[model samples]
Target: MPSEAPVQPPPPIKIGGHCFEWGQRSYVMGIVNATPDSFSGDGVLDPAAAADRAARMVEDGADLIDVGAESTRPDHQPLDAAGEWARLAPVLRALREAVSAPISIDTAKAYVAERAFDAGADALNDVHGLRADPALASLLAARELPAVLMHNQRGRPPVGDVIADVRAGLEESLAIAEAAGVRREMLILDPGFGFGIGPQQSLELVRRLGELRCLGRPLLLGSSRKSAIGWALGREQEPPSTRAAGSAATVALAIAAGADIVRVHDVREMADVALVTDAVLHGRRRGDPA
Candidate 1:
């Protein structure tokens, strides 16, 4: 036998020039933090520099680049739509010129999303999962763009276990999308790894990630240099750059458990991790026989 239970690829999502054939192999979404206060310490404030960084990530094996101007770190300062757009415009413009790969704008504001689309962004990644801004879903539906609706528990207390909490949060996001006329095939689900959960819950969330498959959408797991990795290493003070090995471990495990896309800062390493993990679980290579 080739392997154990294999991934059932969801309907392909075509963004820009790429079609994400989910189960063919794990996909990598490289993080391009444009904020000066980004938690990963890889944020580039200059538009030109950020674009160069994003292009390098693509050459290193990124399927998509998620660019964000706001810092999502806990208790980070908030940016209004105008403020956010100001930070994103130049970076997105440069990114459009620098890379042909799909660009995903990681923002929850309808205003920002609209401008981003005009600037050549191919998709939207709402960490609030359509819950923060009522108009965001409408924008997505109207634009007919692909989106990542993540289950975030930043302010609300969890409902139950990690799996249950994530499931419930994502369901509400799905409901919002459906009501807004967004196509189901254009959506992806992300179980927020470090947003509002503790270390144990985060670990358990990944362990049982497959259970969320019942939601009937592709899953995106992003634990790239998140605080949970530092917690897992028992050194909560460890810097983000020092957590690559732990992030790689989570990437491999998540892919085996049915993750379709992995968002990461260490693109080259995690890309290799996803490729090897896919080969192991799927039992095939680029040119290998069945």
Candidate 2:
């Protein structure tokens, strides 16, 4: 019989003075939606509420907190830079002062990211993956911050195979980042499960997620309470809040399939899910402790 190949470890990234040793265990990124229309039904309108959410997530074992002002839900009303900054700045300032965990600014605009960094955000998570704002990649490069580049589009046709399509799309994003001077080690790849893709394809991406390890960057999967999970649950008509169990299933499978980070809405529940998944998949079995 052939021997199984060893898993290649993902490079470490430091944010807010904490180092994330990828591949050591799956990390949980808690979501703090500063918008009023978050798909997860957990959005908070006030900075104090967002700050409170961040603090609780950190207490619930979240490795980091993702703070986003604009809602990314399908058909969400787009916000201009000023609007986004207006919603984001206060939350970033208060969260930075309250939570010791690293904060990630989820925005596609470079201007918002710049102000976020000024407000003490530790990293940038761009859903458009440099396709929306040309200045975004350069800004991240200049700041030397870790980046999460997600595959994204609007009404694009499939390339027959979903996983291959995701890879090809992300390749274009990688090129843009590299051309803008962002190093490969500073990049993390997200397959963009819900954005501009159908529900079945999103499930296929989760099922074939291990194939994305070929990209050689730490994979961050954000399938939390997405429409895909609702569809998979045979409850496509259900509200996003009802998809927690479905999200947990996907998170566990993602961890088993080589995902290094899982971004989720229900931080406490997903944190416990990741903990057990890590123990089962990454923990060593030896004699009982002395």
Candidate 3:
């Protein structure tokens, strides 16, 4: 099928002193996992080390840092609000003072989000898409901060095909956000890759990612170092750190498909990929004296 007709991007969203000019170029969201059991083996346990890592990512061209204390990988350790906050607090406080870029909290618990907001998190990256915690929407509405409400298929029965399921899930999450007075422009949509589907389905989601732009919000693609890439490369037993090449391939394709943000573990390398791909697809040259 032909790619969807291009639509004008919505107005820029300002969060934590960063202006996200959608459609001008793709943004890079560097991930900082504070858990001991991260799937990617890049988790940082010390608060200072995490802050240092975020500073390095920003230096390497990350637009924002996403901090998470819990591991979302398969069979990972389960974390409660108290446990998560324990690991996330010092890290968030350190990041607030360490880097100039905005910070996004990756969690679904309202209690954790509330405390994270107080501790200086600029945005929310709710993987559960408002389905796990009802209070999260109200908090976001009250804070009026930016958020990424992903179409999470985990533990939910599919309504239809991949795109259909993604659309349906996102629409439901949007409805929930709307009811709580969360502004439309403050929310970005993500198709929850590998959250519920297998490798092929995750790849299909990225291949047809352009179709989701009709949802009228910016899209965020986060297939970095995920198992789907390993499966695609026929190296299922390889470490996540070795998936950078596969990850870069998806980032390029997703950028061409109208992805506005790419959440990644390898910030410097993916930033280069985003820069070049953005140049080719959107004429976003690095040294243009615009």
Q: What is the TM-score of each candidate against the true structure?
A: 0.96, 0.95, 0.97
Name the TM-score of candidate 3.
0.97
How are the candidates ranked when ordered by lDDT, highest leading? 3, 1, 2
Prediction 1 global C-alpha lDDT: 0.90
- Top candidate by lDDT: 3
RMSD of each: 2.0, 2.8, 1.3
Better of 1 and 2 by lDDT: 1
Task: Residues 100-203, candidate 1: write the lDDT tens digits.
Answer: 99999999999999999988999999999999899999999999999999999888887678888899999999999999999999999999998898888998
Please give the TM-score that candidate 1 achieves against the real structure: 0.96
Give candidate 3 regions above 4 Å deviation.
1-5, 287-290
Better of 1 and 3 by lDDT: 3
Q: Tens digit of lDDT per residue, candidate 3, span 38-134?
A: 8999999898999999999999999999999999887987988999999899989999999989999999999999999998999999998999999
Best by TM-score: 3
- In model 2, state the lDDT of residue 182: 92
lDDT of each residue in 78-187, candidate 2, tens digit only: 99999999989988999998898989999999999999999899999989889999999899889999999999856667778888888988999999999999988988
